[model samples]
Target: MPAGSFTMGDSSGDRNRADGETPRHQVALSAFEIDATTVTNDDFARFVEATGCITEAESFGFSAVFHLAIDAPPEDVMGPATGTPWWSGVKGADWRHPGGRFTDLEGRGDHPVVHVSWNDAQAYCEWAGRRLPTEAEWEYAARGGIDGAKYPWGDQEVDEGGWRANIFQGEFPRRNTGEDGFPTTAPVRTFAPNGYGLWQSVGNVWEWCEDRFHPATYRRGTTAEKRTTVTDPVGPADGQARVMRGGSYLCHDSYCNRYRNSARSQNTPDSSMGNAGFRTVSRRGAER
Candidate 1:
């Protein structure tokens, strides 16, 4: 990606005010190299094999999986997560076994690796000599040079162009018709590339960024401080949760409609879920 500036948050009325996707501001970013696709199960498997790194999900003995995607036996299902009835904690859910003990990464090696936490993503980045893109960079790149657009492909509805991205098509939490050709996650490179040649920038799985989560980060006098363009802005200095962008395949307009370029979400550094994954970026402009 080349050095450029863009409006950071949601200005288009379609934002979730509670998620703090407001008070849109200007952000300037430097040239950086971001992966064209999110890290796949095969990609993470290589990292794990090379470094012998155990992900938080594996160490914790449980990870969150969508209710419909859980393939574990009744005994292995740890029950639904608090507040989110649609998500259940499974005993053996990890990147290698996305659903549970009954599921394996047999033919889904090309799909984005889920059940990864911010810390786990960091480990992979360290081993690969790369880093997660900052929230600003992620949004800028996600826009694919089309600033202020609702999505990476610009304001046409997600389903307007023949299921542009992978996301829940039917009713959420109860049924997914797979009208988008995927109910859980599609291949990392399943969608068309954006102007920058980046695929699946918004829908597929939420991609983690190198930023601490703060609802008011866009507020004046908060992080950026000034109203003018802030060059290479990172994020808040400290927070309990890390930022995650690009809503997952579970996103739907009837419910969690956060699949836009400016939508934001967060989770603890060690919390892993089946709908979250990440891509890496090289800070060095000369590196690819």
Candidate 2:
């Protein structure tokens, strides 16, 4: 992609826009190339085999697994998150064993690798000689040349015809109708690509970006101040969490309607969960 500009935040008029998404601003980015798909278990496995790297979740001894996906005994499963009880911190859960020891990536090698943290993603990027996309680059590529569209496909009517992306189709937490043909992570290429040939740009799994968390990064000049473009912008210089975009399978319109192209959220750099994964990008002049 060539250098270009686009709106980079949720619109104030959008009822679904959160307070953090305010002050929608223009962002200018340099040319870059991002993965058309999230990194898959097959992709990560090659990295691990080459580098002998262990993901943070594997080292920390746990990763957040959706309660509905847990197959182990209740006593063996780690407790749920403080506020979101639907997320269970399953022991032995990692990228290879997403639902804990009971689960494996047997026939699902093509699915997006979950249970990965920002640190883990960086490690893989380092090993693969690629890097995570910045939040701006991510949203820019996600928009697929469209301006401020709600989704990669520009269709707000989710699952109207059929499954466009992997996400909760029925009641969340308690039940997943699997109308999207998946209850957990679907194959990386399950959905049609965006205008830019990017698949699952709005859902399937939350993708980590190379940016620190800051709700106000896009807050900028008004009529009183000169307009400026945030050229090839990076995120906050310091923060406790890193940015995650494109929502996840667990997201639903009833709760987290964050599957929109402009939607974003954050997690600690070391935090890993079954619903999160990432892709890689290369600078325009860099080797892939």
Candidate 3:
């Protein structure tokens, strides 16, 4: 973690949705340590080899598979699979089998491991002697001293002649030319790191925070969100789902741009998909 303050919401010039990221407020965070990149296939493999931890997606026997990896033609692609057939409920899909069918993490050991749920992430953190950062800490570290800029890099458009992060570049759900050097997910740290030396805090995948998802928690709550200032603001006690930050490769400006620093979303703790993964944080004196 890095000690700093940022505007903590969408700026005045931002035309994005103003619901979750409204009334830009000041946020301060203390120094902490976050993973240089998301836990990759190789990283998770080490944990699995040691602990024999089977992820929920692996134990449950099915995980969400991106439609792009399916055999369906472009015209055959349908609605959101998590709702419709947009995601294939493939057997054997887990951190090892990203696509669930015949795909494996064989040659792509550096790519960020997917199909991990909140429970899975927490278990990994415990095994690694770290914990998930709160939503506030995640945002603070993600800002990278830019102070409330739209993205981890800055407010400039993504294609401003530099590789800022990995996300959908072309028209989504139809064509992806891989102009960003990746159509799905580039390897973790495929691009540059933020000012604090944090990697992939904005794209590649949406990381799970320790906080619970609350629609108005930031505005009206007795817990972490409402407190004016604190050392480490953990989220609410209970909720339907956990908070997810730093949107995923599936994020698109035309659709889900929650990849922005202020943007947020959530899912059930047990739900695992290709677009959701996580990183861990360690306190100053905590065991490494």
Query: Using lDDT as the measure, which candidate wins?
Result: 1
Q: What would you estimate as the lDDT of candidate 1?
A: 0.89
After superposition, the stretches of candidate 2 with alpha carbons farther than 4 Å from their true spots are 12-19, 220-226, 283-288
Worst lDDT 10-window in candidate 3: 70-79
- Candidate 3, 1-288: lDDT as tens digits: 546665666673443443356545566666788888888889988998999998898788777767775533333333355444556666666777776556677778988888999999989988998888888888888888888588778887767877778888777767766778887778887788888788889878989988888766555433445436444556667788899999888777887777788887888999998888888888443221
- Give the alpha-carbon lDDT of every model: 0.89, 0.83, 0.76
Off by over 4 Å in 3: 12-19, 71-85, 221-231, 283-288
lDDT of 1 by residue, 1-288 (tens): 888788888956888877788788888778899999999999999998999999999999999999999998899998888899999989999998999999999989999999999999999998999999998889999999898899998999988858889888888889999998888889998969999989999889999999888888878323545567777767788889999999999998998888999999999999999899999999563221
lDDT of 2: 0.83
Q: List CA RMSD, all candidates.
A: 2.4, 2.4, 3.8
Candidate 3 global Cα RMSD: 3.8
Better candidate number, 1 or 3, judged by lDDT: 1
Error of 1 at 138 (Å): 0.2
Candidate 1 scores a C-alpha RMSD against the true structure in Å of: 2.4
